[model samples]
Target: MATFETEFLFVYGTLMSGVDNQWSLRLWRACGQPSEAKVPGRLYTLGGYPGMKDPLDGEAAWVHGQLAQLPDSPALLADLDAYEGDEFVRLRRTATLRDGRIVPVQVYMYQPEVDENQRIWSGRFTFAQ
Candidate 1:
């Protein structure tokens, strides 16, 4: 089985700072500061939010996002899980921090079918756009 040594989460969408997702802000408040990170994947728009398809298939590129440490609370984790719903499935993966450090992080990957037309070619997901 895969194990995670740190409680970090790689967020590429609404869970990011300055987004309208207040729940994410509250969760971030309970954790560490957000740090820039990169994951091998492609970001796609799912109407209101974004999802990432990892391992970068032949046509996709690396995804730009933020990595935040999660608090050591099972309740918080549960809350996050519930918030993510069935649309995404959490998994442990390695991400590259802005400082070039590699760390294991929990990434919520999209579970539903993704249309090639919704792919975010910029490799970055943001609400401001």
Candidate 2:
């Protein structure tokens, strides 16, 4: 089990704030508030959810997400790790907040091979209403 250096978690998919999912609800409950943030990456639609991949060389793109403050509890981290599954790996990355502050945050990166055609050019991911 890897230790997290920061308490901030960057969420871009179902775990993002305001999503009507059980895991999202639990996340919001643990994290009282979240701020709009963006990370340098590419977004792709992995079926019903979105996955984020590191930007390729010379690729200028960003992944819009939220930065949530997580409590200092190992249980929560364990839960999150389990929820994300093996396809995603939690990594530390810098996020630019809406206020222009850059901070280190934990972000989940997609591990499987990505199809270039499936890229989400908008960067932001929103559940279909």
Candidate 3:
């Protein structure tokens, strides 16, 4: 169980498109639409939860992701927690949207103990939603 203080997130894989998802509801509440973006980091297949590291940290490559605007409030945090709350840890990160708009988005990173295998979801992404 944990908490976060932010109004945006950079969803890399499933949360993007073609991946089963129902999380966009809360993310789109703040803005009329969520932007398709890429998070500058590395994507790791950590079981069901994907792990990502920012290029700002000096990684050779940046991961691809979609930027979504979420409500910046406690209840929002709680709801987000309830959604992906347990699977990973929420962290603040800067994401470069597909449009090249830079903004801070929350990224739920998988833990170290998490395995890179056994993740059922396809890493293929799109902003179809």
Q: Which regions of candidate 1 are displaced past 4 Å?
A: 1-4, 56-60
Stretches > 4 Å off in candidate 3: 1-5, 17-20, 29-31, 47-49, 54-57, 113-129
* Residue 81 error, candidate 2, Å: 0.9
- lDDT computed for candidate 3: 0.59
Instruction: For each of the candidates, give the backbone clash count.
Output: 0, 0, 7
Error of 2 at 5 (Å): 1.5
In terms of lDDT, the best-performing candidate is 2
Q: Report the alpha-carbon TM-score of model 2 versus the true structure.
A: 0.95
Superior candidate under lDDT, 1 versus 2: 2
| lDDT comparing candidate 1 with the true structure | 0.81
Worst 10 residues of 3 by lDDT: 120-129
Ranking by TM-score: 2, 1, 3
**What are the Cα lDDT values of the candidates?**
0.81, 0.90, 0.59
